[model samples]
Target: MKILNFHIRGKMAHFRRYYSNSSALSYSVPPRTTLIGLIAGLLGFERDSYYGDFDPEGCRVAVGVCSPQKKLVQTLNLLMIKSSNDLNGSRQHHSQTPTELIIPANIRTGFLDYEVWICHQNNDLINTLHTRLEQKYGYLTQGVSAALGTAQHLGWAESARIVEGEEVAEAQADFFSILPVSNVISLHLSESRHRLRLQKEDMPIHFHPDRTIAGKGNFLINASAAPVNAKVKTAVRLSDERFITWMED
Candidate 1:
């Protein structure tokens, strides 16, 4: 299988958790649905229209954090506009609400980076995306215009390369990537590891506005810690230093 690899970074990112209502909590990494949205956006697809084009069985994706993880909580004051007639005959009223926002910490360069891998059986879409990335056209035209999580937070692709990788045994390393929980055949602590900590997050894999659930799925990832020598049954070595476990539906 052929894979397209690229790097994306942003000044700030907030991948809001769907369940968080009062507070805007964020996922440490971009979820599968978010990656799909990004690809759709690059291809100039309409909102909520391209979900069916890329099925989980045919299109596979993986993401890895390329920067140190840091986050901060901020409160944003949003104006709530209501449309109604009051007893005094007022047509509308505006109220302010303070909402909590979790955002990535800004660095000296003011960017947070991530590595993305995409594999699919459809050659047309893959080739188009690869061409766009290589030519630096379409969605890759402007870095800031390509939004990652929210429309307000824009991200840019730093570089892209097509890679044909080989499968290898999983070894001890700091997993900066998000892996599907179902693909994990075995996991263990590292030889030099003292504490074993893993962050399990459930993110949407598929989405449809008409659907009731909006296609949700679960993923397990290590935010920053290095897991003990773990062995994955299906792992691919993208390069001399980069390795990722495939995500399964």
Candidate 2:
């Protein structure tokens, strides 16, 4: 998948890491953050596009998060399972209920070197996930607002473009947002799919060892999101030493 420079914008957030314009900026999250998906009944997002990373059983996917908080991560996993059940609880009248949360690893890294699983298959589940996130966490886009579109998500758009499997194409309605909290920050992206087609040559430009797991044929919409909800001023002035300390912990 080709990576395109992208951005997103919300009430008071924008992703600056990969954004190039004012209207588009979202959160800047570390790579491999856990992304959760609820298996709802209606069609959510396309499979190739939303699926982050799959497991041996093909029942779970990996998503990178900003930190390694066990309690925080487990809560999200459990919530996804419950939401998924609410969406597709009675499919074909299956009995053995699916495990609500699947912890792939006991100790995981925050973004920049970690991944979480998301079981997204339909829009209803996506909606449920969004609502749950918003409620549990006061805000989901803080880093973007604090960063003003110039942080970790520096090359996300370019990466996303490649995912479209196209080259030298034009897209409209691309936006970015940021969500920063304490020593952590997350980036969010939202844009129009119609304008993000790629050419053959552009596909080869986006190949990173860390990003290869997604592989080809996996075309996820450029809605890169994270859970950064740090306070404002403190987030913008995060010192390198402080940032490092946060990650190490």
Candidate 3:
């Protein structure tokens, strides 16, 4: 399999959970939909135009947390717009909303890092995407900028390149990326360097042009930014000897 690999580094990130009602809570890591949106933004894809193309049938994506992270809830002053005329806050109406933000665990000398791997069936599209990222990482120019959920927390792509990998039929192996529940047989949580906190989230799988989410799936992730030693059904072994489970898997 041919995959484009890169790391997104930022000072802060906030991926709002799908079911967050009043307060803006965030996911520990960016979900698959968020990953697709990031790639689309870099490629300058129009709003809601490329979701289908990045779906499971057209392309595959896998993301792994490369750094330890933590969440903080802050009260944000937001405009209380009652109508279109209130958009400018002319009425001096405002609301305090609790917003959750994610940052590096060791904020003193670390940044939020997410390793992204994407493989597309269309050769031309994949090649173009890789070129765009390569220019971004190499020349620090070309392509649009990347942001973590909010535009204020801007991010950049680094170490972007193409990689070659082959599918492995290993029944049980350690995986460095988030694993879809359907792809896992079981996890060996007993053997670990520290306490493990496994959490599952119901994330949107795909979005439609009509502004409605089409599919959703549950995924498991390690909150401590550590690889999960688990039994897996299938995976891709990259040339760097790293194993990853696809988001669609």
Candidate 4:
């Protein structure tokens, strides 16, 4: 049998290559961080679990991860018109990193018993996304095997939290700008809304979207169409498509 050699970062690099012309992402932690442990815990291997030791030396394996759909922008405390120049000044800005993941109420999960909130200041997308999957997607992924790069496929969500009043330095000058905008809808690994799974027999539970007042035509996003990176932008575009599909369904 042929063993598959999968590099977590390398796979993301492929995605980046494909979407580079649209949107690019900067990860706080590489996708490989949880892959090794996932393989060990899932295979029940006590020691080194090399591909050749179990499967084959050269096989084709697919890898994936649950990522956030947002971008980092410099914070400038200015009116919308005043901030127009801030957008133009981003030609030489550093890459933005993902800050957190957003999980909706248990309505997405069949149980509808508990409201789970997992916070991460670091690379928490993995954990948060995992929780959403287990609760909302009928636990499609399991054990340590369900990790970045080791899993059969990857997933993502678009809902996010906004960090306003954050300070970002530009040209050695301090400016307060809300770097990323959090979208109302998030992506989950389910074809149907998890809320629909609740049987009529189950106890009554009230689940609704968190209310927010915003002007029309305003959606959350991290980056714009100015830069040319398809991969980076694909995630957002995919999220939009998913939203449209969900609404239509």
The TM-scores, one per candidate, come to: 0.78, 0.19, 0.90, 0.20
lDDT of 3 by residue, 25-82 (tens): 9987788788888777667788788887887888888888888888889998888777
TM accuracy, model 4: 0.20
Q: For model 1, what is the C-alpha lDDT against the true structure?
A: 0.67
Segments of candidate 3 deviating more than 4 angstroms: 80-91, 136-144, 193-195
Candidate closest to the true structure, highest TM-score = 3
RMSD of each: 4.9, 19.8, 2.6, 22.7
By summed lDDT, the worst window of 10 consecutive residues in model 1 runs over 95-104
Quick one: ranking by TM-score, best first?
A: 3, 1, 4, 2
* lDDT at position 62, candidate 3: 87
TM-score of 3: 0.90
Worst 10 residues of 2 by lDDT: 240-249
Residue-level lDDT of model 4, residues 1-249, one tens digit each, is 111221221111111111133233232222121233344343354434432322211111112222222223332232223356656544444444322222212223311011111122323333433443434433333344332231322422223222111212211111011011121223222432222111011110111122121111112111111111111111211211211000000
Better of 2 and 4 by lDDT: 2
Across residues 19-42, which tens digit of lDDT does each residue of candidate 1 receive? 887677888778777788788777
Using lDDT as the measure, the top candidate is 3
Clashes of each: 2, 87, 0, 24
Let me know the TM-score candidate 2 reaches against the reference structure: 0.19
